[model samples]
Target: MWATGLGSGVRALTTTRFGGHSRPPFDSLNLGIHVGDDPAAVQSNRLSLAGVLPANPVWLNQVHGVDVLQADRVQSDQEPVTADAAVTTRTRQVLAILTADCMPVVLADTRNRILGVAHAGWRGLARGVLAHTVQEMAMRTDGQSRIHAWIGPGIGPDAFQIGPEVRETFLEIDGRLEKFFRRDSSQQGKWLADLPGIARWQLLQLGACDVQWCGLCTMGDPDNRFFSYRRDGQTGRIATLAWIET
Candidate 1:
């Protein structure tokens, strides 16, 4: 798989199971630690993916919140970043996020001088992870850089139905976001969520000039290319990583 940059200098990619040493359930390239996949297998899977990554990836603990961390300071085997987002400026310092059903929103600036990655689940997205990531990236640069974002694969709309409380969260953040949800006629106080579009809008409002999406649904496509938590609760996770090549 080739890494697609937004015509920027950043080297970025989303991994497929074709690589790594993980086995069934995780199958071959699972990169998550808290998912109950064998630790040794997860380690081997990570090592197998390392050669392709620009540097060791900064893996996050991912509690589905809006916290953003700097990748270089992240220690290995420690409590994962806990933050849903991470930003990096130095070359060879990789930024990554693991997800099975949530959108992994990867970003790079126009000049490719900095990169940021965020995990946006329904809760995290509503909690402002995408906007927080853009804010963090701005803090690292001139505080006025125009960024670009590419939202990676995740569970899609028809598959992600949520209750009114979830809708209220985004509505509170930006009432315009309500346009992303369609009321579920059968389920009282429930709506079908448009996760990718919500993420794109969040970034745009934060300062990004361009936003693109892969538009693939992890739950809908099970061709061994993706792992889906919504479809398989015990399944593995995929990594979306980026770094500046020195």
Candidate 2:
């Protein structure tokens, strides 16, 4: 459990690939059920994770899109809600987003009564997932003075290479986005994109100036402790979750 010390009343964590019943490839602590990992292993891992939390995590059937939902609106835990993000002002509602190489962004107002978590893949980011999540949080937080965001691990800029179309998507959002992508000299027609840099730029535009990053890269480490879909084609996912304390 990697904690994000956002402040007094909020708790956030990004799980590691170690500590569960899964086998190689999806080896131990694999929390994603949609991936090829065994359902039993995934459930067992979730159950183990539950023992440490105030309540069961409100998981989403993330579609790599920008849809954001309120945790209180989730009708059933058994139903997989097809949204990429979840936010709540209610305490103890463990809002979670699963990620392997994609970024897991967690947000909380300075008051710590409202919290949000988002799964931001390149598609989601290009489509404004972070911006949408920040808007929802600000709506709930109305007059709050600050919105703090913690950006969890993902494939770093040095490891993420993309084609022209991907760069165009971001440029469509903002022409200045070109600064976040650098030409990969070795790979023609490819550029190394900065997922975290793009996220920080979006958050800052939305007035979330206190953005914090857990500098560890999922694909950079050779230990395989942090799950990386780009590194291992068929791999497990780590959950980066946030909940307000009662």
The candidate scoring highest on TM-score is 2
lDDT of 1 by residue, 36-121 (tens): 78999998988887677766787888898999997767654466657888988787787888999898888887654778889999
Using lDDT, give the best candidate's number. 2
Pairs with backbone N, CA or C atoms under 3 Å apart (clashes), candidate 2: none
Give per-residue CA lDDT, model 2, range 25-66, as digits (tens).
Answer: 898999999999899999999999876788889889999998
Q: Name the lDDT of candidate 2.
A: 0.86
Segments in model 2 whose C-alpha atoms lie over 4 Å from true places: 143-145
Hey, what RMSD does candidate 2 come out at? 1.5
Q: Residue 94 lDDT in model 2?
A: 89
Cα lDDT for residue 97, candidate 2: 88
lDDT of 2 at 161: 89
Q: What is the model-wide C-alpha lDDT for candidate 1?
A: 0.81
